[model samples]
Target: MDDSTIRLALERHWAASDAGDFTAEHDIYAEGAVLDYPQSGERIRGRANIRQSRLVQPNTKRFKVRRIIGTGDLWVTEYVLTYDGAPSYTVSIMEFRDGLVVYETQYFADPFVPAPSRADLVERPGTEAP
Candidate 1:
């Protein structure tokens, strides 16, 4: 796929996720695609399984994409994922083949306070985590 096409697919995927449209959200993945959560040491294989994992999650969810940058068949997305009103900074790395995602790994982390030693050299632009 062309850069524009891939980007559009990614945009659509995230949009579907934000809208809670599960079918649309998983449409970009190949049937055998795999998703990994390294922090939790979990790997979910297959598109149907991937979708099922999400479907079973009980939290009220929201996604706010900050940026997407990549080329060719590799892409990375950085975003804030909020569950039940708590935000977790998240990064998703995706690998594509035949214009569909074949493998993806996502990492999530809660925000942390800036170290006091760096206060003089850093500026804060976002609010503290709740």
Candidate 2:
């Protein structure tokens, strides 16, 4: 997909999420797409799994895209999510093929620092557990 197309797709996804429209989201995600939320310890594989997993909480808020950078089939975006609590920063990396997102990975950017010093993944309960 082109840069604009990818941006539109992401915007539509977030719009549907904020509006609580799962059907719309189903159409946007690729058939085999996967979603990983480390903070929530949720890892969903395939569009169907993602379709079933929706944030229905009344207080879960919206995200504003700050920037989107692309190179070839890879697209990266930085965004801010505002909810009941403090806002959070997120970065999304997506790989597109045949004008559709074939792979995607997102990382929490705010209040989340890697290396230096921190607890290991083993200490985390469900996510690291085999």
Candidate 3:
């Protein structure tokens, strides 16, 4: 698939997610597609597994794509995900075949918050700590 087609597919996928329309998002993936999340050391095989593992989440919200880059059949996107109670930035790499996404891998941001420190959590005198 061309760059524009892949971009359009991602756009539709985000739109579907914002509206909680799982079917629309699911349609973008090819049968038996694979998705790997290296940071989590987890690999989800097939559309069904991906849907259950990646797509389904509590209080799911749309992940907005900040930027997209494509070369040949590969598409990469930087996105901000607002799900559950925390928001995070991540990158996704997609491999497309015949206008459908055949493989996808995501990498979440590292150094997540500069790592919380024990001293930073110390309560001051006569003050309640957060």
The Cα local distance difference test for each model comes to 0.96, 0.72, 0.79
lDDT value for candidate 2?
0.72
Candidate 1: tens digits of C-alpha lDDT, residues 1-130: 9878999999999999999999999999999999999999999999999999999999999999999999999999999999999999999999999999999999999989889998988766685565
Query: Can you give the TM-score per candidate against the true fold?
Result: 0.95, 0.66, 0.76
lDDT of 1 at 65: 99
lDDT of 3 at 122: 60
Tens-digit lDDT track of model 2 for 81-126? 7676667788878777776666777788565545645555326436
Best by TM-score: 1
- In candidate 3, which residue pairs clash? none
Query: For residues 1-130, what per-residue lDDT tens digits would candidate 3 score against the true structure?
Result: 6777778888888778667777887788899899988987988888877777655566767677788888778888888777764677889898888888899998887324343566686665568855
Clash-forming residue pairs, model 1: none
lDDT accuracy of residue 17 in candidate 3: 64
CA deviation > 4 Å runs, candidate 2: 38-42, 56-59, 111-130
Candidate 2 lDDT for residue 73:
78
The TM-score between candidate 1 and the true structure equals: 0.95
